[model samples]
Target: MTKPQGFVSKDRNLHVCKAEAAASASPADEQPLLGEPEQPKFLGIELVTLKKIIPLGLMFFCILFNYIILRDTKAVLSVTAQGSSAEIIPFSKTWVYLPMAIGFMLLYRKLANFLSKKALFYTVIVPFIAFFGAFGFVLYPLSNYIHPQEFADKLLNVLGPRFLGPCAILRIWSICLFYIMDELWGSVVIFVLFWGFATQITTVDDAKKFYLLFGLGANIALIFSGRTVKYFSMMRKILGRGVDGWAISLKAMMSIVVVMGLAICGLYWWVNTSVPLPTRSKKKEKLKMGIRRGA
Candidate 1:
């Protein structure tokens, strides 16, 4: 006997469904044996991933390159500031740097309310570049006139020889200022600004893959900056002892720092504008919403 029409149609549909399922499964079942083709990669990263990672690595390289040069230069200037010695460093860290850091944090919080992350970055970094430029060209040249040598002498006498650390810090206040600002650049710019920016835009998977190379870039910076410092150090011999080699080195180093600072800003702007950063649009919207709420 023939089946009813409704039942016949239902049976036909069931067969079609089974056939579709089997067809889907056949490829999945064979997938393991056939093996998926490997993605084309460069230096262990796919091209798509490299596009995101390269700019970030280059930015890190510039940041760290300037940081190391400034760090080494600051140490030299502070320690060799006539009356100052290594003893002043601990005192400066405790008495000077800590307070400056706290003040800067408070200022940064206020700035965050008023600015976008990109604007905030430029605000923070431009001042550092300006300060270093001014120090190298103008302030260092006027150190003898600006430094409070007589007051430091009187204070030292009053406090006795044991207070030389504090006295030296006061005597070469410009150098101390440079030292504190250098410390802040490392803490604020490198650690807080650059890494914070990196973490905000990068996904967990991308960060894991990219951060290792970012670290590699920093290591390269260390080597490069060391060589740069050594080459400048050896410049004194070529120019003779009479030409004030340290001054020349400071000017040259600051010039490089300024150039690198500009490079960093350029890289940051390009990444913000050009890269297809994840959640970047969301970040901008949130920033705008925050500003509106603040207003």
Candidate 2:
């Protein structure tokens, strides 16, 4: 040691290096973390709250819309006419579906972007008005056009040997679209809206939760909507059949869908408006805040 006056002993050199490494590792010795920390609790709470409220609201709206459509249309395919003269009630309606499907798909994509959650809810109001208006303005008068005898005759002709299988399949497919649109208006539209919203929202985990909650609500709606058709037919006798009863129920159901659509659109708007851009600085800040809050 005397010979090397400027040099530290090996033990002392090693000790100094180890002390520096430990100090570097200690956050207390360094500057505070710069960004917000992960807010697991806050996120968990928000997710849970949304999961409960949104699904329940959707389910109620679904039930109402199903009741309306079922009451009005009865959703039955009756073969009323005999032999070559037979007809089906839904014949013309099937032709209308191809166009409606195209329109619906286009509207869905556009509205998913243009409408806020609030506006989407209001958009559904159109359908409500449309449904009742449709019944009074179109279906009520058309009900007179629904001749059971003629329908049967048309059906028999369509199902005769040559056209039987293919014609039946086409009719069934048309019926499927009719039922799908009627019963699933809210669920389907909302699901599409949510898909757009999920892409907008940066939080992948939150999107996952929201999707699952809404998906469950939709499945439940599908099951209930199918079962309710029978009950609705029976209830219609007591509910009355004149324009007023039909109009009122149809309006009520349309209102439900419209309102629910608005809510979903509103939520999308809120999420888009509220969630900040996920830049590196913001993410770091979020991380720091999250850690501090956790501590």
Candidate 3:
């Protein structure tokens, strides 16, 4: 007979049997508990951090570059209009600025890949020399012979309305050539080297912070450029007039550009050589691992 319904089976040893079952279940419970939790990893660096800094740099570069362009244009235009009845066209012969636009885009991509610091240094210096050297040796001599009155009359007569005739084309082409040789090449070189240095030294995050700082430096440059133009004007007052005065202004602008280039280059070289590469992040390692696994 069943001894009362809730009574334990003493003879069957039910308590010991239940204890053994609990012990067996304990190891199964411990398996999930013993597994490790995932750890957080740092993100890898990227080049986009330079975005803010670049615009600032560009602003300054644009200011200085534009001032030089404007100053040169005014001087050249004046010389071309000298003793002429034709209104000195503000940008009649300044179409050369277009070539500079093209050259800047092209050289920017080229200079970005340069890994060698020395190569970059030379890349910057050589362009400056070639540019100003040609201006000094070739263009300066030609300027002495330029009769603005005659040149303007001939150009306006030939250009007529189409603005694509022989003289117009030549004038524009000449302007483009000058811009490329004198300004665009050097500007791209400087920008590439500066950003390259920035990218190399800082992690993506730090770059975001310092890029703005660099931009502030660039803004200062723009402001400085305006002041420099005034100084050039003052110098022109003291130095006399005509082709020689313009030449001095051009030379002064080039000298400043050259100095700035050299200074930035020196700074870049120092930063490039001195700063240690950023430490790799776990996320980068994981990504590498994933790639390997996928492969």
Which candidate should be chosen as best, given TM-score against the real structure?
1
Q: What is the lDDT of residue 27 in candidate 1?
A: 31
**Poorly placed runs, candidate 2 (over 4 Å):** 1-74, 77-95, 103-191, 208-210, 223-231, 239-295
lDDT of 2 by residue, 215-287 (tens): 5665676676555444544555677455455444444444444554455445545544554534323343222
Q: What is the TM-score (0 to 1) of candidate 1?
A: 0.79
lDDT ranking from best to worst?
1, 3, 2
Global CA lDDT computed for model 3: 0.51
Kindly state the number of residue pairs that clash in model 2.
Answer: 40
In angstroms, give how far residue 164 of model 2 lies from its true place: 14
lDDT of 1: 0.85
Whole-model alpha-carbon lDDT for candidate 2:
0.47
Where does candidate 3 have its weakest 10-residue lDDT segment? Answer: 286-295
